[model samples]
Target: MKDILEIRIHGRGGQGAKTASQFIVEAALDQGKYIKAFPEYGPERRGAPVAAFARISDKPIHTYAPITNPDIVLVIDNTLIGFVDVTKGLTNKGILIVNTCEESSKMKEKTKFKGNVYTVDATNISIKLLGKNLPNISMLGALVKIANNISLESLKNKIKEKFLKKIGEEKTEKTIESLIKGYDEVR
Candidate 1:
């Protein structure tokens, strides 16, 4: 990693934004990196807007609070954009990944974000691949590709190790395969 990277994730309550942040922390830790992942509690209800954060670095992390001025902002729910300023406090060199089917140019025009803005149909991809509206795994795939910290293979292995015990080896393998395919499709 070049420098300590701070990431914030925004999504509706049940969209797996919190889980995605935790997974990213686990994946980075698997690569021998230091990380902190936590969620900012909001109204405890489904469909409510929620936020989570992850900080990854080669050095020790001192901050455990919610991330403002994030270097990377992952928007897991397009609907949340209307309720939250996803780009607020973002660094000028920040990167924004949106889980929308919209074209990159269109999203850029809509948000007027003066940073790298990338879009992926993570919802559709997840539904098609996993038969569930699970966008977190696919969005993580896009994030790993765009962030370019660790190789996708390393992330995949970590994902397998984390998920296999819970989802079973066969489902884990299939999910990994879908993640790879989703990454390739977006990249």
Candidate 2:
């Protein structure tokens, strides 16, 4: 890995892409790394395409521009494949993680992506655990598996601190379950 790791997340407005970016930044910060996280949206409404970027490094990150070539790409919505060039500037050795029920090999074939690939049935996991289709929190688990820069324990703590009070106990527990499932099941 380089001194800096850049990640791009793709999803729709209601899928929690922005929140996932913030959680990643918080987890990286807990590891004493400097981080930046921000989101971009074509339309600031539910179901509109949204992209979030995060950069983590040992040193301070000076760049504020969008990441053109990311070290990792997280696709929260696989349907965006045909609508967006999700793999536009991924590095040759970049890691690609997708939230889908499809097999990783099938996803790679469908996207015509030729790098390291991982897939998790995050949507199904979320639906089973949270009674919804939100996969962002679960996707964080897969991110931790791929990045390894942040500890799952730290990430879970952050999640508790951020979501426990806001969403209450049961929902938060389900979200954590989704996260752990994502970590265990990604391939």
- Candidate 2 Cα RMSD after full superposition onto the native fold (Å): 1.0
**What would the TM-scores of all predictions be?**
0.92, 0.97
Tens digits of per-residue lDDT, candidate 2, 93-169, equal: 98899999989999889888899889999999999999989899889999999888888998998999998999999
Q: What is the lDDT for 74 in model 1?
A: 89
Candidate 2: where are CA atoms >4 Å away?
none
Write down the worst ten-residue block by lDDT for model 1: 178-187
Reference-based lDDT, residue 6, model 1: 89
Report lDDT per candidate: 0.83, 0.91
TM-score, candidate 1, is: 0.92
Best by TM-score: 2
Question: What is every candidate's alpha-carbon RMSD to the true fold?
Answer: 1.7, 1.0
